[model samples]
Target: MVTSLYIMLLGHLINRAFYYLKQKWESRALPSPESHPASQGVLPMYPG
Candidate 1:
């Protein structure tokens, strides 16, 4: 169905976006946490 295709596309897009975002994030020189913080689940926003 067309709805299924749309859902699949949205899922793929979200996966790719997260992948790229993580790549861009690690490329930064941001310091690692002093110990993993509770906020660690919140990735930094891409400033581009």
Candidate 2:
């Protein structure tokens, strides 16, 4: 019974960690203003 409980807790922790890592990866992979060509190329006439 104790072993089964430990296994269940471990499984939950692993699943939570997987989701947290996936979210972190997705946030880093997304493109932002810095990734735009115009932003990286020439300065804008006026700051928007």
- Regions more than 4 Å wrong, model 1: 29-48
What lDDT does the true structure give each of the candidates?
Answer: 0.68, 0.63
The lowest-lDDT stretch of 10 consecutive residues in candidate 1 is 39-48
By lDDT, the best candidate is 1
TM-score of model 1 vs. true structure: 0.55
Candidate 1 per-residue lDDT over residues 1-48, each given as its tens digit? 999999999999999999887766755734665354654547555232
| TM of each candidate vs. truth | 0.55, 0.59
Per-model clash counts, in order, read: 0, 0
How do the residues 4-47 of candidate 2 rate in per-residue lDDT, one tens digit apiece?
99999999999999878766654565445455556532533323
lDDT of 2 at 24: 67
Clashing pairs in 2: none
Question: Please, what's the RMSD in Å of model 2?
Answer: 11.7
